[model samples]
Target chain A: AQKVTQAQTEISVVEKEDVTLDCVYETRDTTYYLFWYKQPPSGELVFLIRRNSFDEQNEISGRYSWNFQKSTSSFNFTITASQVVDSAVYFCALSEGTYSSASKIIFGSGTRLSIRP
Target chain B: NAGVTQTPKFRILKIGQSMTLQCTQDMNHNYMYWYRQDPGMGLKLIYYSVGAGITDKGEVPNGYNVSRSTTEDFPLRLELAAPSQTSVYFCASRYTGTDNEQFFGPGTRLTVL
Candidate 1:
């Protein structure tokens, strides 16, 4: 069985604050994929990043960053100086297998982040 | 490119009615999927197609059906509309590669009464 847990249901922070959203996953497969997606008020999902099992490197894109630790089975996302435009719901997902035999993505319940200015 | 597109952005259906949610992608992706998201919840996979003419059930496929006769389109069919089936349906497509991320459609919001 594969599961992705995002315990934070909601988080509110003032503008320019740094916030981190935690994601923990459970999967027996040695090779799997992790993902982060953002859903703004537009009601459409926007893909943020995808990390494979072999890569444990932390990634930074502008004010957003992701820390992937395979040992703890955790992929945490952080936003530096979060602005009002950053208010949205974030989701963490997991999938098993390589390119050919990859399974469907299993998404966590999601965490809604509110950045108030 | 159009990426992935879904029809009828919003729809209201009465109980027992049948409808098909259309999805089309121009990316020439080999894998396509259908997922439903309830209010304030994550997406639950309903069905997926690996290639043309090959379809499989996902985590939740009881109230839905899907077909993949072509690589560019995968449509989900709802046989009998029920209140429990009311949700926002999303269609996604991805190329057969390790680094490729699934491209999602705008999604269809359905309400069953």
Candidate 2:
């Protein structure tokens, strides 16, 4: 079985503040993939990032960064200098199955982040 | 590219009514999926198609049906609509590869009364 938990239901931050959203996952498979997606108020999901199981290295893209720690089964996302445009619901997803078998993904409850400009 | 597209941006259904949500992808992706999002909740997989003539159920497939008769089209069918079934439906598609990144549609908001 595989599960992803996002403890933070909602968070609000003012402009320029840095915010970190926490995500924890559970999976028995040695090979897996982790993903971060953002759903704006318009109700469209936008893919943010994807990381494989073996890659524990941190990733940064402009104002966005992701920290994947296999030891803790945690993949945390951070936003530097947050803006109103960053306000959205972020989800963490996990996939652990053979492509020929079950390659579907399981998603967390999601964390709603509100940024005020 | 149009990527993935879903028809009927919004719809209203009466109890016991049935309707089909249409999805199309021009990306020529081998994998297509249907997910539903409730208010303040993450999307839940309803069904997915690996290729034409191959479809499988996902986490929440009850009360829903899907068919993939063509590579560019996968439509989800809902029988006897219920209030609990009201949600925002999304269609996504991805090419065959290890990367497995999915592109999503704008989503269809369904309201049942």
Candidate 3:
């Protein structure tokens, strides 16, 4: 069974503050893929990043960063200098990377981030 | 490129009514998926198709049916609309490759009453 857990239901922070969204996953598959998506007030899902199980290297894109730690089974996302535009719901997802079952992705409940100016 | 597109951005269905959520992708991807998201929640996969003819159920498929007659289109059908089936429906597609990153549609908001 593959599962993704995002314990923080909602978080509110002032603009320019740094916020981290925690994501923990449980998957027995040795080869799996993890992802983070952003859903803004517009209600469209935006793909943020995708990290494979083999790649534990952290990634940074502008103010958004992802920390993928295989040892902890966690893929945490952080927004540095969070801006009002960064306010959105973040979701963590897991997918079996094998050829047979790679089409399915299991998503976390989600974490809503509210940025206040 | 149109990426992925869904029809009827918003719809209201009465109990026991039926409708199909249409999805089309211009990318010619081999894998297509249908997922539903409840308010303030993550997405739950309802069905997926690896190709034009292969389709399978995902995590939540109780109230939905899907058909994949062509690689560019995958439509989800609701046989009998129920309140529990009301959610935002998203369609996605990805090339059959190592990345497995799915491109999503704008989504269809469905309400059942």
Best by lDDT: 1
Model 3 misses residue B93 by how many Å?
A: 0.6
Candidate 1 is graded, for docking, as medium
Chain B only, TM-score of each candidate:
0.98, 0.98, 0.98
Point out the worst 10-residue segment of candidate 2 chain A by lDDT.
Answer: A97-106
Q: Compared with the true structure, what per-residue lDDT tens digits does model 3 show for residues B1-113? A: 98999999999999999999999999989899999999878999999999988999888989899999998899999998999998999999988764879999999999999
| Predicted structure with the largest DockQ when compared to the true one | 1
The per-prediction CA RMSD against the true structure, in angstroms, equals: 0.8, 1.1, 1.1
Best by TM-score: 1
Per-prediction share of native contacts kept: 0.68, 0.42, 0.57
Between candidates 1 and 2, name the one with more favorable lDDT. Answer: 1
Count: clashes, candidate 1: 0
- Candidate 2 structure quality by residue, lDDT tens digits, B20-111: 99999998888999999998888899999899999998999999999999999999999999999999999988777647677889999999
In terms of lDDT, model 2 sits at 0.92
Per-residue CA lDDT of model 1 for B25-80, tens digit only, reads: 99889999999999999999999999999999998999888999999999999998
Arranged by TM-score with the best first, the candidates are 1, 3, 2
Docking class of 3: medium
